[model samples]
Target: MSYQDPAIHRYGQVIGLTIAAFVAADLLWLPFSNITVDSSNGVAVIIAGLIAGGYWLAGAVCSRMARRSRLSKVWGAIAAAFENIAIFLLAFIPMSVASCLFMYLASSTARPRLDAYLVDADKALGFDWPSALAYANSFPMAAAVLVFCYAALTWQIPIVVLWHACVNGRRRLLEFCAVLFASSVLTAITMAAVPVDGPYLYFKPAASLYDHFTNAGLSHATTVEALRSGPFIFLISKTVGITCFPSFHTTLGIVITYALRRTPFFFPVAIVNALMIVSTVPEGGHYLVDVIAGGLVAVAAIVGVRRLADHGRRIRTALLPSE
Candidate 1:
């Protein structure tokens, strides 16, 4: 509902979180000279700060307005929640960059060798697969996946966040966060385990999107190499490594689709996202096998999150009893 001093509490939280995130980032960067020295890293920090600050400011303004207008508590909560979600999403940029650095460092020990094995397996699989299902062979199927992937990154999260804010419902917000967290964890693991140079770096004569990968600054191997070279080099490399085996791009799309399934307009959005995921094979330089694996991971993450939420609800119900 509407709080009397909304701006006071909310703005304080915003400022505190911003300062903490900055301090934490700086502290984390201290040991890594490359990351600390990299200009891109600095830019990333600034961008993250600005984004967080903007959302915080927006939320403060919205809260003040809501208080004055005596807006419904549900609407106010939705606004606040969205405000936080935007900040969180924006914060992901720096976090993701940091994660890549961490990924490289972790892989340096025994992961490189392990990755070599994965690469070999990917090569053995080959990219070519005959059309088994007629639907699978359609061009429209590929186009749909491409659109879905693009929208998920560009649109879905924002839409979901807004919906959560408008609905002011904890369940949807928690679901959204769970999906994102699960996807991120799964992606990090997959990238670590199956770090391929993608079709471009690993395969020759670059067919389809593989050519784009070859020409792009960051294929999968480039990311690993960037890690080896240090954060500065990695930052400068510009090209995100193309780990094709389990396309997080596709996986995230699936996660978003599932997360928004209960919301209005979700079905159409989900369909678009599903298509975009399918398109990853051609548009994202992934193999059919990679898409399948990514899909399965998304499914597992969704199921796990649902079960976790259910368990949490049960616990809450038991504790609260009937109100």
Candidate 2:
């Protein structure tokens, strides 16, 4: 196999291993906790599996055609792109489910919430979250834009799929996905260690911001509450962000923006994600500290993945010559 082939395969294996770890963690926790996931999430997982399977099948067909055709590179690229899309969907969606499960499980801990500490850190940094939120509420149009931009965290998946399919890339795409997995693992670890009630719940911002919260359908407070000290039914379809120590929205905004670097879309993504980070305070129910820590986490994950990829490539090169 080509050196390039091993890189892509390694990316897939790493992601698969992480997801399996997440699954194992959830299984270990579920039986002991009062939390129960509804059937909706299982059904959603099934649907996602079907979609990813279809992409993989298409990629296989493309690969077969590439082997027999004159335009081998083009066909091979298409195949790789399809497989990358499938890998992304499989990695992101289910990992999300399992991680969400772990988040709720973490919330059940008796450890004190970190809202005060986080808010105090924000204050120490001279960041006024309440005032900032009020200012944002004044400009409804701007707030709307922020909301859309924040939602870009989810919408960017399709953009990634398109980018990979259209662009000639294997290494870049793998690095992007690997960074996401790394960031997620770090996010999960930190979340499990430090559970927060989030600034929105702690400060209880204005009715306007509350409306923004309600409309977003995140309801992280409710989920956290249910898991902490209430009798509530949790479902996978109803997953919301409960981890606030490292603002995942912020992490995603940074990571996704970085992934699009060198493309025409990079600057636009950077601008949107900049706004997305701003929205995290109001829409994401996060503290300023969370955003700062999230940026740090993003940097760490990016550097870590790049170094790991480089090291892996070096080992492979030392073992065998390129075809």
Candidate 3:
């Protein structure tokens, strides 16, 4: 028997509804911000949309034509995987673009910088940001490892999706995906309200401090300032990571590890992801408080998604009652 998880559809709806709201928001806010989304981004989204649609169509056709033959079975499995990929791409790609827009729009509000309080909180916790950066920069191999792990988040997502699609781990895949959206929303809930300058810019760490350590956070300062100040202009194709309070990188570290658990990728990936959080503190220029909050947000998002799925099941049972 073929088993399908109900939560897959439910979580898909979470993304669908979220993207709809985001699009509606863009319509409402773009006029006020005087922002122009780069044409290249639209072109990319169109191409991605076509590819997603093609994958879905191929999946449908393959499923219908799949026969008992060995080749057909192999093609069927591949098509099924493609179908899962299509599902993720359809929801996630839009979510990604929309969320980026949301970040900029949130920044336009020009909230007061929270770097002082964040740094103060770090001091209160007896953590020294400069000392940590110096320590990280002192080791070349370890710094390289941190750089690799920090960069791993971008690639790790698709790999997890592919793993689950191949293994028919649909529920796990959707749950992880839901956790992603949930964490993003949870972290960005106070974006405009709790704007932060981040530790690297706030501390103004000396040039010599990060020679060996690649501080990825320094790269986005230009774009962040562009949005925060007047004349908010951004090229969508060139959008960078902007959130700091609840670092999305930190959130992904936890959720990615959670998704890959019990698999061969778990130990190595988890070790890297563990180090990824450490990397975020120095490389991403996040305060110790940001890391702590991000960890809490990730755990909350994961647990919250499970509860939402359960609540959805209960609602469905009450309505259908026939199943």
Candidate 4:
């Protein structure tokens, strides 16, 4: 019997529930809160719908091709893998935008600041972020290299998704997407409980030492300004990064590394991801505790996703009624 991939449907169910919760929360909060709906958010929703439609269309085409030829199983599976990639990408875009909006909304609800506590926790652990930043900045070349790796997060997701889809197969690709979904959800939880602006803003003066390393237009200044204005809109132009406490960058590094494990790309990917995680401190202006939290979140997400997949399979088997 062909092994059933539960990750596919499991992904859909989880995503649907997540989006529903966010929409409900947004509606409930809109009346009493200072937050206002922006047209950009609507644009984001429409774009997400388009992407999802394309994903389904691709899957339909792939399925038709697969069933039409007896000797094309390999190619058919490959096409199906691309379909899987589409589903994942479609899921990722909306999930990311939703999570960002969720985090910002949560931040707006909280009146007190949490950055000082997080900074203190870092200091208590003997992780001096300032000294670390200074040391990193001392080496311009190294700092530049790390910054490049840090920026890789933007393109890494699609590239890794494509790589897994084309090379591994549907099951593995689904597994990766499942873990990502879990991580993104966990990120919202952690950020809401303790919203922070990261080390750059918390340590603005000290961070300015490395101002030369930062991109010209982007800096802590812009983030601070946007954040002070109000809650982030889904597709708001130049919306600031509101997540802190746990570094999503660190979480991403762990997830990617975990996804690539047991493959020929493991060692190389490991090194790159390791750099990416470490670079989070300086490049991302994240506190040490934040990075630790992100790593833990990644671990939990992987374990949780696996158990979910296993439970889904067991339930499916039980319902199969006598072989």
Candidate 5:
């Protein structure tokens, strides 16, 4: 395998190991906690796995056909996409599972919230979260529009990763996946340590233009109970939890923008993603500091991934015999 191949494979290995650890933790916590595993998420995971596996199987067939028949660019392109199917799936599913697992573990522990500190920081930075929220609530139509744009995050990540993995080269896909996973790890750790519920829950903004609390479709009481109990189920239909330290949504917005930065739609992508980030304040229940931390994480991931890639290339080149 090439240097990059091992690096890419390591992502899968790490996520798989982390998943195992989560399972182990769940089992260990079963004695003391009341959380029960909801099989729905497991079903979702299985379905996703099967779909990704199907892509790989189809890609392999196309790749073999391309190699055997007359050289054709169209077929080759198709085959290239199939070959990267594994990269897309491996990058996505496992990372997602690990995130959900870690989130459950952290929240269940019931660590003291850092909302007061985040609020103080926001005030110090001259960012009035409540005023910002009131402004958002003032324009119902605008808030609605922002909410829709922000909600795009659910599909945006998978679509972008799949599109790039198929159309772009493996290196870009690998780097993007690596960065996402790394950023997730950072966000999870920060959340576990500083566990804040965000401005929405903190301030209890009146239910008017923004009814995010209801719109979220989650019962805060049930969610808290699940966190404190055993089985620690990751629900498929309701993935949102009480995560608010460094805003993962804001981080995702920056990452998505970064992913599409070099494309022809850079300006439009930037504008839309900027709105997504801005929307996090009211719609996502995020503090301003959360957004800032998320952006910093994005920058770090981007830079770190590139540096690792370069270092891998150097090591690989050095090991090769001189001409």
Candidate 6:
């Protein structure tokens, strides 16, 4: 199908709006109020906001350019709105909170065993790989990737949104939502139960790259320390410290790929995302086990959500008459 197809455009719109809402929340509400910027937590929020805003704005402009039938436009707007609402309440907020809670709970539960393990693991693995991975994990690399990604996704989001707006009578939105919710829930549960400070932090510091990237984190840490901050700084540091078995970068990359699988533009995006995610192993100081676990989580989440959505659709179709 042509990239300009309405169905593709509509899908883009939904994804764009979904991303935009999260970004807007971070920029407008979450950063200064709910989360403090003294630590690197602010970096995640900032990136989310920028990417989301860029996608949302780009989608809006594309919608205007498409100038489809009134009904199509209305449906597109409704879909976009619905997607934004669902993503915020169902995916973004809950997932964020759950991730935070899981990290804390995992830390408390695993600290004793984890500390001892880290000593041995560090001796065995050393820190060179971890350090290189740390450099890859740094702000500069992430920023560069995000910038490139946002530029590409910006153009693609509009195309997908408009396409969905125009063609395909299937109720894919509900299906998409069902999958997202289930995947997020599963991820949260797994995160809570299997929290491990990833290999780099636990087994060994990625010494080489860690030394380079650690400087930024250390600088940030030092600034906070100089202020004589108490619990908040500690909390932030802890949040940054743990990096156990699972690789969220891989998991989320897979999720995004699955979510956009139906769209043509998703092809290139998915490939790039997959590469970026896999690179996290060496860049983010994760072990092979971490990457594997992350990939498994991603697959499970996608499959579980899809199955549930399919079942729901079957039930609905059985009850409803065809128009």
The lDDT for every candidate, in the order shown, is 0.56, 0.79, 0.81, 0.72, 0.70, 0.48
Over the stretch 248-292, how does candidate 2's per-residue lDDT look in tens digits? 888988998898888888898999999999888877767888999
Q: Estimate each model's TM-score.
A: 0.67, 0.87, 0.91, 0.85, 0.84, 0.52
Range of the 10 consecutive residues with the lowest summed lDDT in candidate 6: 212-221
Q: How does residue 169 of candidate 4 score in lDDT?
A: 59
For model 2, the local distance difference test gives 0.79
Off by over 4 Å in 6: 1-91, 114-178, 203-206, 209-243, 320-323
Model 5 lDDT vs. the true structure? 0.70
lDDT of 6 by residue, 1-323 (tens): 33433443444444445445444434554333323335565565566656656545655654564476557666566545533433333334334533453343334432233434433554475534444455565657664564344234335433433444344323444335444444444554555455444544444554554433333222223332332232333233244424345666567666666656667757886877766565555545456555666788778866765555456556756778878
The most accurate candidate by TM-score is 3
Tell how far residue 266 is off in model 4, in angstroms: 2.5
**Model 6 steric clash total:** 38
Tell me how candidate 3 scores on lDDT.
0.81
Model 4, 1-323: lDDT tens per residue? Answer: 12356655665566666666665766676566555657876786677778767866876777787788775677576666657767676766666666666665666664676889988898899999888888888888898888877877777666667777776456777678778878878888888788676776667655366764664213544654555576544455445665666888889988987887787777776787788888888778788999999999999989987887778888888888896
lDDT of model 2 at position 283? 72
Q: Model 5 misses residue 290 by how many Å?
A: 1.1
Q: Against the correct fold, how does model 1 do in TM-score? A: 0.67
Tell me the TM-score of model 2: 0.87
Candidate 1 — which residues are off by over 4 angstroms?
1-43, 70-82, 90-94, 104-152, 206-241, 321-323
What is the clash count of model 2?
0
